[model samples]
Target chain A: MNFFLGIKIFFRSLFLQSVWNYERMQNVGFVFSLIPFINHLYKDKTVRAQKIKTHFGFFNTHPYLANLLLGIVMRLEEKCLKNEVSQEEVLRTKTMLAGPIAAIGDRFIWSTWRVVCSFIGVAYYLCSGKEGVWYQANIFVGILLFLLIYNLLGHLPLRILSIYWGYKYTNNVVDKISKFALQSYIVKIRNVGIIILLFASFIYSISLISDLKIVLLFWLNILLSLLLSKKIAEVGIFYILFLLNIIILTVTNL
Target chain B: MKLSLWFLFISTIAGLFHLDVMVFGQFMFSRPIVVAPIIGILSGLPEVGLIVGIITELLYVSIIPVGIKIPPDSTTVAVLTVVCSERLIDIPVALFFAIIFGFLYKYIDIAQRSFNSLLLGWVDTAKAELVEQRVNLLIIYALFITYLKTVLFYLIVLPILSFFIKQVFCCWIKNLWVHMDLYNLIYILPAIGIGIGLAHFVEE
Candidate 1:
């Protein structure tokens, strides 16, 4: 039946996953977590360990680089499995590529694209005439599109990096990229630059709030921040904002 | 095949109230794009239920469990929440369910820690045995405790919760959530965008 074929596809995907699937069963756990029923089949330790590695692999890279690395690794996994490459080579290749891909994916996909999409989604939600399933679906699709396209493209360079330069070459490529990204993002912006950017953006966002009372409530937050600077937890900002709104509602006739 | 229904029913009931289930705690099993829909059919309201489940899946896509920390278990939350809303009420309600599910996830973490403690105890017992047998017992006991506690919790609690939702409550508890608002929901989109942007900005 079709059900059997589906199972076959899933297994093939798993196999494809294994080639670049360095994290092993952890990815399986992540993939299955999306589904509602089959989380049980992959319950054993071997599976869990594998998936955990894949899931936590992000810590190794810049967000964008991590996604790209994963994409390439995924492609590599598929092609290598189909070609019946040796297990030892696959292991060696993975050990080599994992670090570099993680770096790239983190920088490009996780860092950059995620921020861009989130802002777009937020803007759409904030504006009128954009409040329905269609809008929601589009936002979701936007996120998916970024993940898919960037990841797929990221793999292409990785293939060349791993194939031509091999492990050392790949490491060199990662090192350069990391050095370049860090210099540009952190050094160029610096602390003052980031603070200015945050202030500007914060002001722009506050304009969208429209409700004067709400604006006033948030304005108080600046003073609250200074007053509580000694012991204020970042999370307390959210709580204070929430409390402010409740207090405002109770006091105002509107 | 019949057992699938048992899993479906037990998972749904256990998920319905956010109660911790035994044995079959792996609700993520039902989350596949294909499999979840099929399972939804068995439970009734197949179409909406499946779609809702998928939406829930997408919302929590990036959330992957690692180490001892368990992210919110959306499997039970998504399935039972969708089923309850469609049969008894509506779809927007599922969002509220997602939030509550996020909180319940903390307890699941506690359960995992408890499970790990039992594993440590087994390791101690294994230490006293022969070196060869000790290794085997350690692996066996470790896996056994992991699987057993989850399964046992689901089997005992799920049926009881199901009866309560169906017979006693008549889904009344859901009414308490009706006043919840969907205002500023769209803000989450831009928040994600900002997060993504910052992430990218930082990386490069």
Candidate 2:
């Protein structure tokens, strides 16, 4: 692929879900992303049309990791055009890799990395043991830290690098990802998140400790959340707490 | 700045950041942690945004947007919570209403995706030359629709809801809240979020 065409497709991948639909989620976005590449590779209108149609099946993956798949597909298409690889292999690669890539992206990005970054930010905000003090510059830094670390370190570079790795490694990209041992990193990150969260809670508890009942109440709610998250939505838990608040208000005329 | 100006500005910001949720790169921009504080700072109320953003983040920490499951729109809740609090609404009450609206917004999200399905047939049948332009058109339509829906909702609903909550609920609950010491109740929200997040770490 021409370097400029690769750059164009990378930019287009940012809009990978601009028109996601239930029937073929991300298919439109995929077609839109690959159009520049198709135009670059195939001159004949008929072949370009056939190539476009080839990718028009159900396609959904975690958006960030989808860049890797895009790279691999582009590489596959290049080989297919030269009759080095069969069209079926190109299509199969897209379908086969979609599930695993989505799983990795969802776990790493959504479940692990996002949680870690959010807690790091939240913990910083509460670290000073101040409540309702919004003017503190530390809190601003805290939020900014989350955004900066998450994007600069996690999302932005990963999107760009995944494309490079996927293209360079081709079908071996998954094997490369495995060698990186993302699950172990996820475990370490989750552990750090848990520590930061606990420490932040401890800091907050110090400020609220004057009211022993309130501290106990706070712990109770935490216990409730831990127990109820699977069974109830956050909205339901929120209202339930409100209902409990009504009872507490009625029972104790504080 | 006028309240109308604030509404328009915030609506625009909300729409832009919300694009991160699904319409574009999952860049974490739409996460409550990122948008809430910025939106909060923009509205001249940084504390409200930070606290709401933190609590909201912890609250929904366990809810992952994996696969077919459509979890509650925590980003919407964060944006609405900060926006609602900016109008001098009580943080807890503001959260209540925002959660309701956020719940409703999830349905709107599902509906928008469903509507996008309408163009699938055309995409399948279009000629090659037409396919590129048509896909481009569809993307613009999808983005425009999402942005417009959020902007219109904020423009119309925020004033009425803020007024009613300020006039009606605040009047009744202010003294009661002070007496019961539930003002500290907002603190517990983070605990719940923290707990849920802990569960995710343990289980996931």
Candidate 3:
């Protein structure tokens, strides 16, 4: 691949979720990102259009890791053009790779990395002290810190490299991804996230320390959250607690 | 007049954030940690935004939008909550309305995704010429329509919800502030979020 075409595919891959329909789920987006590659591979309009038609099948995967699939598929399409690989093999690779990549990407990026980074950001904001004149400046900095940590450490490298890695390894990129032992890292990050969450929650809950009743209620909230978590999501617990707080405060007349 | 203009501004920004969640890269930019604070800072309620943002973020942090399953529209909740909070209505009541809007917004996404399936038909049967151009156009049109749907959702829903919450709040909680410790309630809301957040990491 030329530098310009790689750059084209990289940028175009960012729009991989642009038309995420429930029916086929990112098939159009996958085809869209590969347009340049198709045009480059097939010289005739009929052939190019036929190649496009072949790729319009169902395609879905985690957005960030999609370039890996795109890169692999691009390579496969090229190989198919050369008659070294069958079209079924190329299509099968897409369907086969998508589910595993999506699982890894979802667990790593969505479940672990994003959670850990934002937990740190929220911690920073709590430590910055929310009661003073500098709170706005503090929030601004906290937000900048989050956006920086996430994009710089995690997002940028993944996005810029996913396609190249996929193209280079083709079907074997899973071996490359597995060699990282991301499961261990995901566990470690989640453990660290727990620490950050506890410490930050402690910091944010400090104001209630002076009010004995509120402190008890705060601890009780934590216990109840733990107990009921499996039964309902945090959001549901949030609503129930919020309504209860409002109701108790008003009914008891504080 | 100034407040009206700010509402317009906030709603427009909210629509863009929704686009980030749906169409654009699912960058953490669309996360409540970012969206709520931006709306809050712009509305001169930075602290409320920060607190609400934390709570909303934690509430949503565990959700994975895997496969075709649609997560609740937490971004919409954060955006509308921050926009309607404190200035137009009380935070707690605004939150209730915002959560309702959040659920309602999912219907919009469901509808948009279904419509996108129709657009899928266009690409499935495109002529031999300029199929790439047709796909590009369809993607752009889908994005534009999603943005418009979200913006219209904000424009139409924000006012009605705010009004409804204001009336209910005034009748119930507004005059009851003599017995209310609003800050306590606000502080505990995040405690619940943190508790739930803890549950997320600690389990399994």
Candidate 4:
């Protein structure tokens, strides 16, 4: 029954953003995902309703990492039902875990992992070039490979393990997670991977530019844009570069 | 460049899934790199889709939603760029309009989320009444609102933008394309994208 409940919650956790609101942020979805476990633990309808109401309070975190919280909460709730733990304790645990977990998830998954995967994807597509009988096929493969690698390798394992370990070690799960050392390794690997991909893409871009003057201009433009990106919003820089291109083209034609 | 109903329908569904499923499943399909190519392939212009996707993806690499602050909606920007570019306007022009609309849609998303808070009052009342089913109903309502927003955005914007490009700006764009070496322009956009991507690492 515990195994079934964990799997059910995992599936429901996917809908973590369905009813996202400013007041409570992922509260409804979080509660909804844990409904099965809540029902299983609290046999009485009123108790079940009470437990659900308790979860309806403000709860926001990265959606992916929320599964880990859900697993840990389920274990705590089970203990609470057995009079081994208090309701306040479970609520406090949820509140404590939300922020740190969100920070780790936002940094590692959103920033580092995603950036690495995208750089690699772009590099793959660029290197493939727009030629040959299988050019279109190559592009499709490159895009799919990025999606597969990101979802399969990066996201799925983290989510599954978080859920599993959250259940296995309900007490001090956060400390265990913090001391895991796997995340640091992943970040290190991602940093190295991004650097390699950037160099590859730069070399490829250079090869494509035959004219030395144009190549120098390209590097100059890249440097200027990089400096501008710090001060200006991305969209702003995009518009400026775009207008510059139009103006340059118009002048060259004139 | 006639628009196909099938392409429009598929793109809308893809847009819906990109936001909806991506949020739920944590799949990166919502990213421009993935969404653009899928839309491009469906529209029978995979190359344009791939190019637009890469540029948009790189440009918006740093725009992750860290906490409460919402990033400008890159997925919408990408889908609209590819779909609109299929008609006739240059990819950059399509991208420009898409970026504009993307910001517009971002505001709309914020408004929608704010509006959703009103629904929570109903949820509270339902909880008081002990009608837990109402909460589920409200969730479905919220999801529907999200779906409707995407569908309506595409249904209204793509055709109008395509028409405007075809009617008013056609000759101007054509003239620009004729006079300009587009190859050089293409190289410039990606270079900026690469620079932005690299900038994130350098900062860290």
Can you tell me the CAPRI class of model 1?
incorrect
Model 2 has a clash total of: 1
DockQ for every model comes to 0.07, 0.66, 0.69, 0.56
What proportion of the true contacts does each candidate reproduce?
A: 0.01, 0.68, 0.70, 0.48
Cα RMSD of all models vs. native, in order, equals 12.4, 2.2, 2.1, 2.6
- For model 2, residues B1-78, the per-residue Cα lDDT tens digits are 598897888888888988878777777778888888888888788878878888888878778877766787888888
Per residue, candidate 1 scores C-alpha lDDT tens digits across B1-204 of: 674467556454434333212112222233322233444565665544444443344344334333233456555455544544435234434434343544455475465545433433232333222322332343344335534444454555445444545553445744333333222222222222222223223333
Q: Largest TM-score belongs to which candidate?
A: 3
lDDT of each: 0.38, 0.81, 0.80, 0.76
lDDT of 3 by residue, A1-254 (tens): 77799889877777788888888899887888898998888789988888888888899998989999988998888888789999999999999999999999988998888888888887776654335322334777777878888988998789878888888899999988999989898999999998987876666556456676676777778778877888986667878887777677666654
Which window of 10 residues has the lowest lDDT sum in candidate 2 chain A?
A130-139
Which lDDT tens digits does candidate 4 get at residues B1-204? Answer: 346575469556765755643245758878888888888888788877888888899999878887778888898888888877754236777887889888888888888878877777665655433646766676677667777777877777878776776565565556657556654565567767777777776666
Q: Can you write out model 2's per-residue Cα lDDT over A53-78, one digit (the tens) per residue?
A: 77878899998888899999989988
Stronger candidate by TM-score (2 vs 4): 2
Model 3 chain B scores worst on lDDT over the 10 consecutive residues at: B175-184
TM-score of each: 0.40, 0.94, 0.95, 0.92
Q: Judging by TM-score, tell me the better candidate of 1 and 2.
A: 2
Least lDDT summed over 10 consecutive residues: which range in candidate 4 chain A?
A128-137
User: Which stretches in model 2 have alpha-carbon errors above 4 Å?
Assistant: A132-139, B86-89
Which is the better candidate, 2 or 4, if ranked by DockQ?
2
> How do these models rank on DockQ, best leading?
3, 2, 4, 1
